[model samples]
Target chain A: MDVNEKYFKNISNRERAIFEGAITMGALFHQFIGTPINIKSAESLEKSIKTAMELQPCINKVEIEINRDILKKIENEYEYISLTGEMLDVKVESNFSDKSAVIRLKYISELKYPLMYVEDVD
Target chain B: MDVNEKYFKNISNRERAIFEGAITMGALFHQFIGTPINIKSAESLEKSIKTAMELQPCINKVEIEINRDILKKIENEYEYISLTGEMLDVKVESNFSDKSAVIRLKYISELKYPLMYVEDVD
Candidate 1:
C-alpha cells in the first residue's frame, strides 16, 4: 500500500505545531549531547528533521537552519542537555502568502545562539 | 507524555501530502458510499479531514467546505463509486503569504460538482 494511504490517519491540524516542535527537538537532541558535536552531527540532525517534518499533510517542503559551531560549543561545556525541562523556546508560524509554515526553537538568550527553523511547503 | 512528544516521532514532511490526501480520501469514502449522502456526510468528511490534518505539525487550524447536495445526487445514480480508478482530481496549494495550505478534490468535470476543499492554517 502507498505511504499516504497508511498514515495521516486521525490527528487534528492544530496539534501539528507540537508535532513539528517535538520532531525538531528530537533532531537537536540527537545532534547535540553526543561524543563531540560536529558539522556532520548538525547535518544529520537537519536531515532527520527535514525527513520528519515533511511527512505531515499539506507540507510539500521543509527547510532547516541551525548554527552547528555554536551548538557544539554549548554541548562541550555541558555534560548533558535536557530538552524536557522547558529548556527550549518553540514557535510555530504559518505564512499563508509564502505557502510555508515555520517551526523554530531557540536555546540561550544570546543573539543568534541556536535556532532551528523548519519550513513546510504545501 | 504530551501528544507532540508522543506522536510526530518519525515521518517525512513531504510524504505528508500523500498522508493527508489519503486521510481526506478516507473521509470522503466514508461520507459518500453505502449510505444516502447528506450534509452530515460532508460534515463528517470535513471534520475527519480537519481532525486528521490538524494533527500534523505547524498546522494551527483546519477549514473544510464541500458540496453535499451534489455528492448526494451523484451517489443516488451510481451503484458504486470507484475512487482508485483515476477518478478524482486532487490539488494541494500553499499560500505562504496567507499562511495556509488548501487541499481540494474534484469529482466531476462540470464547473461545479463534488468538490472538497480542506484548508490548513499554520
Candidate 2:
C-alpha cells in the first residue's frame, strides 16, 4: 500500500495490538542494547526507525530531540554517537547565578535497568 | 601543630563551625565552578582539600568515588579528568541480562548549580 493509503487505512484493533507489540519489542531491544543510541544523523526519524525496526522487527517509529549544548560538548570531547532510548525527557539549564550547568532527566518510561552512562560526543 | 598534635586537638564547637564553614564554602565553590571537578591523582584527599582551599578560602575537604567501568569508557574514548562534587553517591551495575551498563547517582548534598556535564578521563 502507498504510504498515505497505509496511514489512512483505519487501523484495526489487531493491527494496533501488533504495532504496540512492536514498540514493546523495540523498548525491549532498547533495554538490552542500551539507550540514547545514535540515530541523529541517520537521514530522518523514519530512517532511524527503519534501522531500529530492521534490528528487531517491532519498532515502527522514533522520536529524538538533540541538545545542542550536549552535542557541542560531545563534539568537543569525543568521537562516538550518543544515544539512549531510556531517557524519557531531558532538561539542560545553565545557572548564571552559580555559573554552572544542570542536566535533569524526568520519568524515563520503560527503564528496566538503571541509568546507563553515555559519554558526550564532543 | 604537629601531625599527631593537630590530630589529637579535640574538635571544639568553634572549630567544628569553622570546619562546617569550610565545607559549605567548598560546596559553593563547587557550585560556581561546576561539579565533579578533577580531584583524583592530586596525591591524597588532604592534597585535594588543599587544592580546593587554595582556590577558595571557604572550602576545606573533598570526597570522590571513581567508577572503573566509566573510567575505562572514558579512557578508551577521550582524555580528561572526570569529577563532580555535586555527585553525592554513585552505583555502577553491570547488566548481564541485557549485556549493558547502568550508572546511578544518589542525591548530591550541596549542588548549587545544575548538573555539570564533565567528560570522563579514562
* Best model number under DockQ: 1
Best by TM-score: 1
Ten contiguous residues with the weakest lDDT in model 1 chain B? B79-88
Instruction: Supply DockQ values for each candidate.
Output: 0.02, 0.01
Query: Alpha carbon lDDT of residue A36, candidate 1?
Result: 35
In candidate 1, position A26 carries an lDDT of 35
For model 2, residues A71-115, the per-residue Cα lDDT tens digits are: 344332223332333333322222222122223333233433223
Positional deviation of A71 in candidate 1, in angstroms? 3.8
Q: Which 10 consecutive residues of model 1 chain A have the lowest summed lDDT?
A: A2-11
- Please state the error at residue B107 of candidate 2 in Å: 22
* Candidate 1 CAPRI assessment class: incorrect
Which digits, one per residue and each the tens of the lDDT, describe model 2 over residues B17-84?
A: 34434444334333322112222542353345435543532222333344333333433122333233
Provide the TM-score for each candidate, comma-separated.
0.26, 0.23
Candidate 1 local lDDT, B18-115, one digit each (tens):
23333333333333333333444556655665676455334444555555444545654443332221233444443322244445555544433443
Q: Candidate 1 — which residues are off by over 4 angstroms? A: A1-37, A72-100, A108-122, B1-122
Query: With candidate 1 superimposed using the best TM-score fit, by how many Å does residue B55's alpha carbon deviate from the native?
Result: 20
